[model samples]
Target chain A: MEQYFVNKVIENNRFVIEDSETFKHVAKVLRHKPGDVIYLVDPEQNLFTATIERITDDKIETSVNKLATPSTELPIDVTIACSLSKKDKIEWITQKSTELGAKKIIFFSSKYSIMTWKKNVIEKKLIRLQEIAKNAAQQSKRRIVPQVVYVNKLTDLVDHKAQSNLVAYEESAKQGEISLLAQTLNQNPNSILCAFGPEGGFAPDEINFLNKSDFLSVGLGPRIMRAETAPMYFLSVLSYKYELTVK
Target chain B: MEQYFVNKVIENNRFVIEDSETFKHVAKVLRHKPGDVIYLVDPEQNLFTATIERITDDKIETSVNKLATPSTELPIDVTIACSLSKKDKIEWITQKSTELGAKKIIFFSSKYSIMTWKKNVIEKKLIRLQEIAKNAAQQSKRRIVPQVVYVNKLTDLVDHKAQSNLVAYEESAKQGEISLLAQTLNQNPNSILCAFGPEGGFAPDEINFLNKSDFLSVGLGPRIMRAETAPMYFLSVLSYKYELTVK
Candidate 1:
């Protein structure tokens, strides 16, 4: 069953899906007939079982009934701030991070970043990435789509810091800095954010700036993960620590 | 620093890079001079720093010296038995699984597998996937490359079972089964293997068969992950439990 995020909430047992894009998807693409059921998520983050009553010229008239589905959002909010990479890598990071329960996916330009978004193309790229995040969230059956963001400089990350901020440092893992990530999670911060560098890695001054901004340098593990792989690692660990494990 | 896996044990202080592929990579592609250094892993999984002594016609002579770099292999052996998916998904799974410390990557045909390996193309596909594993292993600086395997039937997974066998079942998670993944990890099993279903998921008969074969169905979380994303989640959680967390 496909789920769509509606722009408005259902006030009564009757609802109409009027968005042209969604109408085309539900009516034309899937070729769904009357009596077929789909999921609808409202702006208030509530899920409803929408059974198609009739297909009109522009609206999908549905009988809206709320269902007691378990929330798919993570208890501890997680933000993954990644340095800008190539087109495919960033798109992959966005899609996978959304599935792994990130609340916000932040991409920033770092010293060693491979491709930085130009001033004019930033809006179009963000719209495309936001579309990817929405599709992935829907595919994963998440309650809310994770917000995608971009920061122009490493210094901009300070404004979006969480209670527990971290920078994945490979050198620290090489030196056997293993316990900090676990210890930080043990503290049970309500929200946390982690930053990952590009293929060439962050410059020394960039790391220093983040460190001074209260972002602790943490090591994921012994093996070195690629720039895109590390964010997925962080998000999965978050889900395991908060959702899977018994607290 | 680049790393190459040699086919034989480096017995003495001097070694020659004889493999034609590695020779092409080091001598022709990278164009290394007499003083350039690279890391080499022998069949015994020993790490050695090889400094170039001379670059001959078909081989590169190097002085081998042992290095005290700590092992990057995970504490617990892991095997991921994923249902065969599209070419891109399986290739992505192989590369990421190697980076995350999977000892064996198994692909089996399930009732709902999207693509089944033909009798002819199996060998060629496995070779290409194995090459991906080797490259990812070298990139992530692992001591050993993960071996890729394929099975004609789901029952073949029994021959490759580990001490702890699990199948990621979505129904189990929907029933609110939590704490099993954590408790299983806490048991300190020496080896574990988990199977994942395809896009449409496993058929009921396949699940029943696996259940009868001592494969416990485990829920990842509340969210529904794609077939490819679930294995990465499993591998990342293993890395966190065995490598990052205090055990």
Candidate 2:
């Protein structure tokens, strides 16, 4: 069954989709006519099995059967605060991270970051990234679509509070500082904020600031991952530790 | 410091670079002069800090200063046997998996695989992937560059023996089969062979074959990952379990 994210709320066990894009995708592209079954994911991440009842010129009416139980979301909320890299790499990271169960993604400018988001076109870029996240979420059967946020500086992440904070620092791996992330996740924090650097990595001042702010510097492994590969690795390890390792 | 993988072996504390690509990169791109230091990783995965002694028209001579310890290779060997995906995705997998410490990558044809490799061009493609692995290994400062191998079918992997074998099955994930991968890794298998499907996933027959061959069907997480992302996730999880989480 095909799945589509809708913006409307279900009322009296029925909901009408008025969005032109989704309507076209269902009624035109997928050719989902009356009596066809499809899944509708609401804003709250609740999935419903819906059967198409009627179709109008600009809208589609579907009868909600029941709520589905299986969730594709991770047990713990993970927010990736990564330094904005080159254009293609950032988009790739957004798509892959969404598939790996990231709850939120924030791209910020670091001391060594090369790309800077322009003020006037930042909204456009955000929209593109959000679309990528949505497509990836649907393809991966994720319950929630991750939000993509852009910030001007690393300090911007300080305002976004989480139960735990970590920075993917390569120096820690060089010094063989292992088990920090595992130990932190073992506490079962409701949410986690992980920060990654750009091509040149975080500057000394940035590391000091993160350290002072109680952000534990964690290492992915001994190998030096590219800027785009770090967050995906972080999410994968999180999934393995929190989801796969648990019985 | 920049690192390069050389084919020559060190003899009497000196080695001459003969490979055209490495020679050009060292002499033309880096513009290294006499007495400049560079790190060379040999075929044996040994890292040597060398000083440039002389630069001739054909080759550059360097005297080995000392050997470096603390390798970046994983404790256990991991081979990713992925169904041949699109050109870019397979290349991306090779590069990222190399950075994540995969010892070998084998691309084989699956029942649902979209792209098929031609026999005449397969060797060339393997060389290209090998070059990508080499570059990634150098960038990640890995001790060994992963070998890229090509095969015809899933059963071909039966010839490539490993202590542990796993297949990333989405159905297993949907069925909520967790802890299998962690349990297998906890046994500390000296080598592992993990296989991933193409976009459409494995055919039923392939799954049956894997099951009969004692390849455990493993779930990555609740979310579905792309073909390229699965191997990277597997390697990341392996690194976390065997390397990072170790005290």
Candidate 3:
């Protein structure tokens, strides 16, 4: 069953999907008719089974029944703070991060960043990335779609800090610093964030500033993944540590 | 500071890059003249530092010095076997899997596979994917370029079984089959391979055959990942378990 994120909270036993994007996807794209069943996640991160009762020109009315499933979100929030790259790479980071259980995705312009969203284009680009996150979240059956944010400067990442902050520094991995990431996850902070550098990686002063700002330098592994692949590695490890490795 | 895989072993303290691809990349693409240094991984999986001696008309000659750095490969060998997907998706899987330390990558035809290469095209497709694996492996500084394989049927997977074989089943995860994966990892299997289904997932009999063939149905996590994302998750978890999470 396809999952759609609805904007409004479901108060009654019924709901209507009025968003043109959702309506078009459910009605015209899939051509779902009355009696068809689709999953709906509300603003409150509640999953409901919506049985289509009527499909009008603009909206689909459905009878909703909240499912008893637990939230699929990770136990701890993980925000992947990455330096901006090309358009496709950042968009891919957003989509893959959402699917792998990122709570928030932030893109910042670092000293070595190849591209940064201009003041005029930031809003449009963010909106597009946000849409990609929503669709990926729905496809992955996530209750809440992750928010994607953009900042012009790398230092701005301080504002989005989680309970524990770390930067994925390649130098750390080169120095055989394999244990810090696991050690950090061992503490089990309420929420954690890991900042990934762009293809050129963080300049020395940038790493120094982040280190001073309390972002511990850590390594994902020894392999040098592309800028985009690094965050997916981080998110997947987070999932393995918190979600899958329950003994 | 790029890494290239040379087909021949480094004899004494000298090596020659005879491969046309590596020659062009070192000579024409990167334009590294004499005295520029590069890392080389030989056929024996040995790492060596090669100082450019001369860029000849055909091959680049370099004086090699073996580096004592430990291997970057995962302690336990892992292979990601996925049902054939679209061209872009499978290619992405190959590249990401290489970056995440997959020792082998296998693509097989399953019931719900969207497309399959005919015998004539199979060689060509595998070459493209293998090229992708090589580039990703070099970019990630892998000791070995993972071999990419193709099989016509799901049953062929039995021929490639490892110490612990797993099929990433959505039904398994939905049933809350969580502990088995970690448990299997705990056994310290010398080598492991996991098969991933296509977008539509494996057919009942396909799963049955794999199960009967001793392929355990393992759940990755709570959320549903797309066909390509699941293998990356699995490989990342393997790296976390074998490489990083040292007690």
Candidate 4:
């Protein structure tokens, strides 16, 4: 069934989708008619059941069926923090990470980052990335669209709180450290943040700062992965380790 | 240090890089000056220490110092037989899979695949994907480039012998089954072949075909992944399970 996230909870036995974009999608693109089933997730993370009854140019009216209890969110809130990559590549990461159950996508400008968008372009870029996250969320039937944020300095990361933190580093690969990621998996914290570097990678000084912040270091593998691919590799493997393997 | 693969074995104190791409990369792009160090890997999988002695637009000269043995080629040759996805997405998978050490990439047409290129377009697409594999191999410091091939039928797969065979299926997910990927890793065979579907995914009849061919079915995870992302997720987690976790 097609899924959409609505900010308001179900009232009575029906939910109204008045948002223009979602209304157009459910009513126009999907061409859902009366009696067709669809899912609506409200702000409280509660899933509402609805059957399309009436479609207007501005609103989609659906008769409520019942509430849903299943959730696609991971037990832990994962936030991927790294320098912004090229536009297309960042979008790729956003989509895949959303599907993998990320709660937030944070971008920073590292000392060695290859490309940095102008300050004025950041908002537009972020909006586009958020769209990617939204689509991926709907495709994966996720209840939430991970937020995308921008940070300009290391202090920004230091200010954020997560129960556990880790950075995937090539130097860590050289050192043969496997337990950093494994230990994080073992701890199973309320939230975890995994960070990656940009094209030129984090400078030695940057890694030192991360180290001071108590960010554990992890290694992906022997082979050197490109900047964009590393995060996907990390998240996918992490998901497999905790979600699939344990159950 | 930057790394380049060379053809000749380092004997006593000398090695030669004769491949055109390696030559151009070392001689032209890098403008490697004498006394500058570059890592070289030979066909025997022996990495070496080499220093540039001469530099020219069309050629470069280097002398070997010592043999270094840093390699991650799996004991088994793993081939991924999948349907072609969108151009950029498939290219991304090619690059990441090469880094994860897949030996061969094969594209087959599945009954429900969304995009199918014509015979004339196949060769060009394959070549482009091959280039991605090559660059990924170099970027990851891989000694060999994984070969990319295209086939028209599932019958062709049965003809290729491998110690183990498997297919990833969404049905397995629906059944609440664990991924066979971990089990496949445990086999640690000389080689394995894994297959994945395109965007629309494999038909039920196609799954029957794979079953008859002795391909065990597995689920990647509960959440659905895009066609290109599935193979990368499988290979990365496999590499982690075998290469990283074990040793």
| DockQ each | 0.85, 0.85, 0.83, 0.61
**Which ranking of candidates, highest TM-score first?**
1, 3, 2, 4
Model 1, C-alpha of A178: deviation from truth (Å): 0.5
Model 1's lDDT to the true fold? 0.93
Candidate 3 Cα outliers beyond 4 Å, as residue runs: none
lDDT of 1 by residue, A1-247 (tens): 9999998978899899999989999999999999999999998889999999999988999999998887989999899999999999999999999989999999999988878898999999999999999989988889999999999989999989999999999988999999999999999999999999998888999989989999999999999899989998898998899888967
Residue B76, model 1: lDDT of: 94
Per-residue accuracy of model 4 over B1-247 as CA lDDT, tens digit each: 7776666666667655667788888777777778888987766777777888876665667787765455657556889888766777677778878988899988888888766778888889889988888788877877787899888776687866478888888778656666466666777877888899987888898889888888999887767787887888878777777666664
Superpose all Cα atoms of candidate 1 onto the true structure and report the RMSD in Å to 1 decimal: 0.8
What's the TM-score of every candidate structure?
0.99, 0.97, 0.99, 0.93
When 2 and 4 are scored with lDDT, the better candidate is: 2
TM-score of chain B of each: 0.98, 0.97, 0.98, 0.90
Ranking of all predicted structures according to DockQ, beginning with the best and ending with the worst: 2, 1, 3, 4
Q: List the residue pairs that clash in candidate 3.
A: none
Is 1 or 2 the stronger prediction by lDDT? 1
Number of the candidate with higher lDDT, 1 or 3:
1
Recovered native contacts in candidate 2, as a fraction? 0.86
> All models: lDDT?
0.93, 0.89, 0.92, 0.80
Q: Model 1, B184-242: lDDT tens per residue?
A: 99999999999999999989999999999999999998888999999999999999999
